[model samples]
Target chain A: EPEVTQTPSHQVTQMGQEVILRCVPISNHLYFYWYRQILGQKVEFLVSFYNNEISEKSEIFDDQFSVERPDGSNFTLKIRSTKLEDSAMYFCASSGGKPQHFGDGTRLSIL
Target chain B: TQLLEQSPQFLSIQEGENLTVYCNSSSVFSSLQWYRQEPGEGPVLLVTVVTGGEVKKLKRLTFQFGDARKDSSLHITAAQPGDTGLYLCAGIGRAGDNTDKLIFGTGTRLQVFP
Candidate 1:
């Protein structure tokens, strides 16, 4: 079965530096989403994208965060300035209608 | 804000035991989904329930959606070591909103020992 794929399985970045997490959702999927899980915390929704525009975002997805579908296949989340609290497991998901599929996730660590 | 709460945050059972995990919410959802995640990985979808009072079965696992659409339950019969994982329940946002965004439950960690 086709699955969502994320790059840079793990990343370490300095505080105040920028980091971009990349994902390649299933080819035929239309809806894409970003979510984060702090260590031992519940998964939290960050943002959702469809038709090349942000459909919705949470408070955690503030000014520092931005998402782009630079190409037909790539969906990227860029954080302008990383902070210690920004360290978490970021997951990318895609869905055709229901039952969204998730990638393995990218673990972001800020130093 | 919508919130999903799961009961029995952690469970440990011997092989061949039966277990159940529950997800509850005060707010109604258009749909609910169950997922399982192992260490060092993202969640994998197990099942999706769209209608109230719907029941879906996948081999030894069974899922049921509440009649009010505000809760769901997952039951595993004769669980094996492979059934050990973190189970999460998520509620899909209401229609006309960001329906794709999933409001996830606190999670239930299951450890089945063989």
Candidate 2:
């Protein structure tokens, strides 16, 4: 079965540094999303993209965050000036319909 | 903000036992999907229930959506150690002008012992 895939299973970055997490959504999927889960917390939605542009975003998706489908097979989330609180497992997902498929996730650790 | 609450965040059970986990919310969903995640892996799709009062079965697992569309349950029968993992419930928000948004439940972590 086709699945979403992400790069950089783990990343450690210093405060004020920039980071980009990349994902390859399932082929033929049109809707894409980014969500993060702090240790022992609920998954929080960051942003959703469709038609090569963002469709919606949550409050957690602030000024520092941006998403781009830079190419046919790659979607990326960039965080500028990482903060300690930015540490979490970031998951990339795509949906053809009701159910969404997810990537293994990139665990971001900010020091 | 939509909130989905899952009960019994952690569960431990013996092999061959049966167990159930629940996801509830105040908001109604147009569709709900269940997923299972293993350590170091992403959630794998299990089932999707679109209509209220719907029941779907996969192997030894069963899924049910509440009549009101505000809740759902997953039951694992004759559970084995292989069934141990985190189970998540994600519901799609009521569609508006073709936008498909989702809210995920808190998640239930189940450990099946042998």
Candidate 3:
């Protein structure tokens, strides 16, 4: 079905360290997005990318967070300084237009 | 802030039972999508409803979008244990914009017992 794929299914890092989550969206999908789900909380949007630039971002996406499409296939989300509250399941998604397909997710844990 | 409120946060039903989950919002959406997620996994899209008052059926599951585009419903007839999962409803802010992000619902967790 050509689904979105994320790397490092689980990530553990020190509170002050930097972390990068990687995703490879569907090859033909043009729009890419990042979303996070805190344990027991609703999934929250982080950012969306299209035409090689950020189209929209949520308030949750603050100074510490940044996204990059370093190459044609890889999209990455980097957190400059991780915080305990940043621990959550980060999901990557892509869509041709209307409905988006999501990856399994990267579980980020800050120690 | 756009919020999608899903009713009856949790539901438990025996096999062969019918159930419905509702997602409502005060803000209008161009399209609504329903997804199911298992533990430790991301949401898997099940259906997308674009037109107001549109109804689409997949197997034993039926989905409906409200006439005002502010709400949607999912109905499962003769649900089985395989249907147990967290169901989420997500809405796209604008109709034509290709860059609109999805606003997810609070979620409805259903446990269908065998």
Q: State model 3's lDDT.
A: 0.93
Error of 2 at A41 (Å): 1.1
Lowest summed lDDT across 10 adjacent residues in model 1 chain B is found at B92-101
Q: Which ranges in model 2 have alpha carbons more than 4 Å from their true place?
A: B94-99
A1-111 per-residue lDDT for model 2 (tens digits): 888999999999999999999999999999999999898887777899989999999899999999998877899999988999999999999988647788999999999
Q: Write the per-residue lDDT of candidate 3 for residues B1-114, one digit (tens) a residue.
A: 438999879999999999999999988888999999999788998999999999999999999999999999999999999999999999987445554788899999999999
Please write out the lDDT profile of model 1 over residues A20-92, one tens digit for every residue: 9999999999999999999999999999999999998999999999999998999999999999999999999
Q: Which segments of candidate 1 are over 4 A away from where they belong? A: B94-98
* Model 3: how far residue B59 lies from native, Å: 0.7
> What C-alpha lDDT values do all the predictions have?
0.94, 0.89, 0.93
What's the CA RMSD for each of the models? 1.5, 1.7, 1.7
Q: Residue B52 error for model 2, in Å?
A: 1.0
Docking class of 3: high
Report how far residue A2 has shifted in candidate 2, in Å.
Answer: 2.1
